[model samples]
Target: MRVKSPESLIAESGADLEGHGLKRTMGLFQLVCFGVGAIVGTGIFVGLSDTVAEAGPAVLVSFVLAGITCVFTAFSFAELGGAIPVSGSSYSFAYATLGERVAFLVGWCLLLEYGVSVSAVAVGWSQYLNELLDSLFGWQLPAALSAGPSDGGVVNLPAVVVLLMAATLLVRGVRESARATTAMAVLKIGILVAFCAIAFTAFQDHNLTPFLANGVGGVTSGASLAFFSYIGFDAITTAGEEVRDPRRNIPIAIMICIGVVTLLYCAVAVAAIGALGADAVGDKPAALSLVVDDVTHSTVGGGIIAFGAVVAIASVVLAVMYGQTRILMSMSRDGLIPRVFERVSPKTSTPVRGTWIVAVVFAVPAAFSSLDAVVNLTTIGTLAIMVAVNVSVVALRRSHPGLKRSFRVPLYPLSPVLGVAFCLYLIWGTGWTTWVQFAVFLAVGVLVYGVYGRKNSRLGATPRTGAAAEAARGA
Candidate 1:
């Protein structure tokens, strides 16, 4: 149970993780866009239908609940991201406070979060692309090209293309990627706002009647699904190394992104419900666009929203994949995985090799895997990681009480404790099948760690406890 020291991680922070180090081109604005970019995609554009299917109009409340749940864990992430400011994010936090083994497992779980989540967002992008095409020209790609096997298609070519597009942007450099994300984030927000405005004009009280269409059980289930929409806020922490003045910027950016996104999501839910009624909004793909179509009685209006969704989900693919690459880059530096992933392209200062590998690996599944499976897996995995992050905050507080923290959890232990409880409560709402999937993923992670990770881990060469204590005291 030897842990890496937080002081050491902070001291060794930049450039050394990967040769040439990542370029710190991101400021507060770009960093906030990164979080909004990763989070604002997919979940609201396409998955809103599914969440509404579960919770009805009460899905609006579900957004608030999920946001509150994430707020608790986010307080912990803000504290650690500021104090540590590394690319490994929760994985690095766990290594500093928990131990090597826990770090490995936490990183493994992160793959399910960022990696699978990117794939899910890509698939959502494909659906929106189809929506846009049909709206503009009354035509779309054939099912064989546009859909996955389960959806009665040979392949989801659009999903693969969008994933690669994001990978290419990421490979070029972080600044370019951040610029693209920021522009897209602004565009998508405008589109959603516009949709809300139009839908409000036609708001009908009857549409929102019987708000709890499915009852309390449905609202709980919907909150679990809505949780996916807020999934990417933690991604702000993933860019710790790439952001300027990370200590102050990371926490501020995370809070701003969540506040903006939550307000927007709740507004969108209310507008869509009021405009189209619960039944119309639920179980319908491209649900927002459909509502605009109904309210305006024009396909062109829907087409505009569809176009925005395409851009929105594409940004998620770009942003989330960036986060995934950095996570692996951090893990590789620790020798928990091959060093190839750790190698930075000196020219671009990006993990080019790992970025492509992540895109290709996730692309295959996005082409054929079911969206529900990927979304559920990502949600559960993220919840587990949040639990670890909250615990790490508590552990680090006790382990290094003198550690300088720019921000601290407001209520001490109670906030993190509640964070854990809220996460577990949501997990309880998830189906047993998702739990089984997570267990299997964990078992595989353990096997990989026991085999290659344990032997090659950088810490294996050091007397961990003594060195860790010295490093802690050095702070």
Candidate 2:
């Protein structure tokens, strides 16, 4: 067998075995829709209940604080994304500037962030599913039939169903998938607007009397929960290869999506709490569903909210699944993970294998795990990834001076620094248990690298290696 030249090895290292099919088809509008679809999901539907429970009337402040933190990180993400128009989003960017080890960590973190995010959305879907069922039939699914472990249910059938449905849609292609997501996004936002409008009519100023009832601790917890809503902002970056003029549009879409979603969240939260009162919001036996019903005094109104919740959770699953597959595709192409995940179908221009892998990975958890458990794990992963993103932006600017960036972080070091600080603060608030879990997860990733990723990595695999040698010998 002949040993291939070093140049051949490096060239093959960058090769995309799956054949990336995304050829800049999305425009500003489509990118915005993608971000909106990913961002406006369960955070508003089920998360509000969690936030109110944690912060009481002070949850409003939590939303604002979380929004501010998001603004800072959004700038960092926009800058890095615009600077590097790659399909893997931050993972690719880190690989180019921060080296392979750092890139691997980013990819690992994203696995948890996107994976748990999809499952969390599915779990949220189960709640609305039961609610919708009861509203129409005047009967509800038994606890054993619906809900998750944390929510006092045995199985989460609806959550699994949503994941499989999303997986199917994602395996089809980007254009059709985006269209489905856009439709769902419209419906979900429309329902929220309608819910807010109706609830506002019954608002009582006195309901907001103890606005700071839960104090700083409650507000911080609310902000942490609220951060889940903003995860969609990064989803835009995952579609970099599919966006038209990614350098110009990615940043705009991210910021615009954040602004739009923030406004919608504040409006709905204000309305829900004001009409029902913070105590009422927190005390409801069914929480969110009960709040909607209390404000409207009609089962039909609760049903509308339920319908919206279903759409919101479904959209989140779809968008997060799409993001996860794309990241895995990029990782596989880069030789960080197994190559099979990078294989895109020639006929469909989709990562069928990758999509299936993501679906199965998340669906099992959706079927069996508790919501809060997965959500906290996801939150820690997301915050860690955001910190990486902020650092990556600063490092890239200093290290890659010649690289042209279409959108630059407005304040350069300040923006990135503040972004890192905010993310770190949130991570700190997640408590010591989350940190320990994150450490264990990272350790597992390290072992995977030692056992497989290091040897198989496209980065480390020279053409003279066994696999390439065998191929050349066969040829």
Q: What TM-score does structure 2 among the candidates reach?
A: 0.92
Scored against the true structure, residue 153 in model 1 reaches a CA lDDT of 92
TM-score of each: 0.97, 0.92
Predicted candidate 2 versus true structure: per-residue lDDT over 179-245, tens digit per residue: 8888887888888888888888988999887888888888887788888877768999998777888
CA lDDT, candidate 1, residue 394:
94
Report lDDT (CA) for all predictions.
0.89, 0.79
Clashing pairs for model 1 are 15-21
Choose the strongest candidate by lDDT.
1
RMSD of each: 1.9, 5.4
**Each prediction's number of clashing residue pairs:** 1, 1
